[model samples]
Structure formats: structure tokens, C-alpha cells
Target: MPDPSTLTPVDRSGGVRMADVSQKSDSARTAVAFGRIHLGEEAFQRVRDHDINKGDVLTTAQIAGIMGAKETSKLIPLCHDVMINGVEVDFTFNEEKEAIDIRAFTKSFGVTGVEMEALTAVSVAALTIYDMCKSVTKDIRIGDVHLRAKTGGQSGNWKSEVSAEEPAQN
Candidate 1:
């Protein structure tokens, strides 16, 4: 993934303005992102057993994530309103880490890429898990958020060499 610092700020060139993609032809684009939420033993079990008082943690989080991806344009200013063709949010239980592993995939055919949407999906999914499981434990920690891969854009295809499954201690 490109360093966030390397990305052009909205106001970096001249005055603030949305980048023009009008001349760029629409193309199939997709982005995948990953995130994790660490939970205490009790909380993890409650989630796995669907014993949370807030209801099915994974299902609820999945839905919230898709919705979040759809709302990415509104959440982040300057993002072109790309029509998302599909969105998927899947979760895995990492027993060793005692964490819920989140993966989000977003698809779109547009001049702009759907990287932000994919990222937003993972973020909202992690946040949803934290929200629904907060009552059981407050130590819930969300981290290791990063884009795994992206395709179809002027920048071309790319994948991160670093694994996003583990959160950095810092």
C-alpha cells in the first residue's frame, strides 16, 4: 500500500478541489481491506456463541460494514460518489489472538477507485464489534487496519507485503 503521507491532500494543489476524473474512462475497480478487534476471553466466547445481549455480533457487524461502505462518499469529504457494485464483509475468529478478523471487499466500475469504501467497511465493522460487545468488556481494541490490495486504476494493481492479521504493539 502507498504511504498515506504520499497521497495528495485535497488542498495540496492550488485551492481545494475534487480531482477531475471526467476524462478518465470508467473501469472495473476493487479493493480489499483488513482489520482486527481484540476481545477478552469472555467477550470472545460471547461473540462466538452468539451470547451477546446486543444480539448476533458478527451478523450485525457485517451489515453495518456494508452500509458503511455504501456511505463512504458521505463520510469522507472529496471522495467521488462512485457506484459500488458489490460489498462483502467477512469475519474470522482468530483463537490465538482472541480477535475478530475483518475483511472487506468493495467493487465498483468508475473513474475513481473504491479503496476508501473498502477501508471504511472494515473500520465500521470493527467499530460495530466493539459497540455490541462493549457491555461484556471494555478492553476491546481495534487495530491493524490496512488495505490488502487494490486493482484497476491509473496507479495499477498493488498488494501489501506486510500481513495485516497482527496489530502493531505501538
Candidate 2:
């Protein structure tokens, strides 16, 4: 026997497999993730004023984020395809830092937590903004993608010690 107690994500054959959540009980789970895209001053103005040629950046990105959350399992290998109960994507324009902050909240009533889904939402939202405004400025940078908090599952609730500071208006 391969010592069931010591079984890891990889089997004896050395192949990666999704974690088996079959034994886990159904529970309400929620996760929040955040990210930001630094768009230079001129580009930021265009986005803030909705003057971008591509269209409404925030609205389009929000929709993309929700879609991304639902499709997380397809994009990330080994992630379970759980039924997401809800997904919310919000954006805040930070004039002081010349960046747009993205926050994604995901909820599920399933065995696995929705942390990955929340993260995917933030990442895709940032990417969508980049894609929409790349013509205006290739200098845009996407950074600070992180999981802010998570609740439920076997581990219970947890929060990140690094708090995100709101950007001040110019």
C-alpha cells in the first residue's frame, strides 16, 4: 500500500491530479481577491473620462471578470469545476497612484473554496483593461495580484496581513 495517509497531489506514478473533494462536506465558501493596473497619467485620464476608443473600460472589464470567475477551472489546470453562487467585480480609480484597483468577490456552496475563482476574476479584469487600452499606452503595468481573504472550508476564515491602502485623489 502507498500509505494512504501520505498521499499527496501527485500519485506514485508521478502524475498531477485534482484534489479529491468527494470526502469533504458541502459548505458555504467565500473568497476575495484584488489586483491593480498602473496606467500612465494620460491613459488614466482617458479611462477616467471614458474617452478610450475601445469603449467603457470599467464596464467591459467587470463583465469579463465575472465570465473569468465562472471559467476558472477551464483556465487553471487541476481546479475543480464548482458551481459558483455569486461573483462581484468592482473597480476604483486611484488618481494619486495613476492606477485602477480591482476587487473580486466569489461565493460558492460546495466542497472547495472559491479562492481561485476570485483570483481569476481579478487577473482577467486587469488583463481586459490592458487589452482595451494597449493602443493608448503600452506602458501600462499589471501588478499586486493577491488573495485578500477567504472563508469556510476546513481551514475556516483567514485574512491577509497586508492591507490595501486606498489611493488619494490628485
Candidate No. with top lDDT: 2
Who wins the TM-score comparison? 2
Worst lDDT 10-window in candidate 2: 161-170
Q: Each candidate: how many clashes?
A: 0, 0
Model 1, which residues run further than 4 Å from truth? Answer: 1-14, 164-170
Clashing pairs in 1: none
User: What lDDT tens digits, residue by residue, belong to model 2 across residues 1-170?
Assistant: 57643565666576777788899999999999988899999999999999999999999999999999999999999989989999999999888889999999999999999999999999999999999999998999999898888999999999887654743211
TM-score of 2: 0.92
Give the C-alpha lDDT of model 1: 0.88
Residue 163, model 2: Cα distance from true site in angstroms: 3.6
Model 2 ranges with Cα > 4 A deviation: 1-7, 164-170
Model 1: lowest-lDDT 10 consecutive positions: 161-170
Cα RMSD, model 2: 3.7
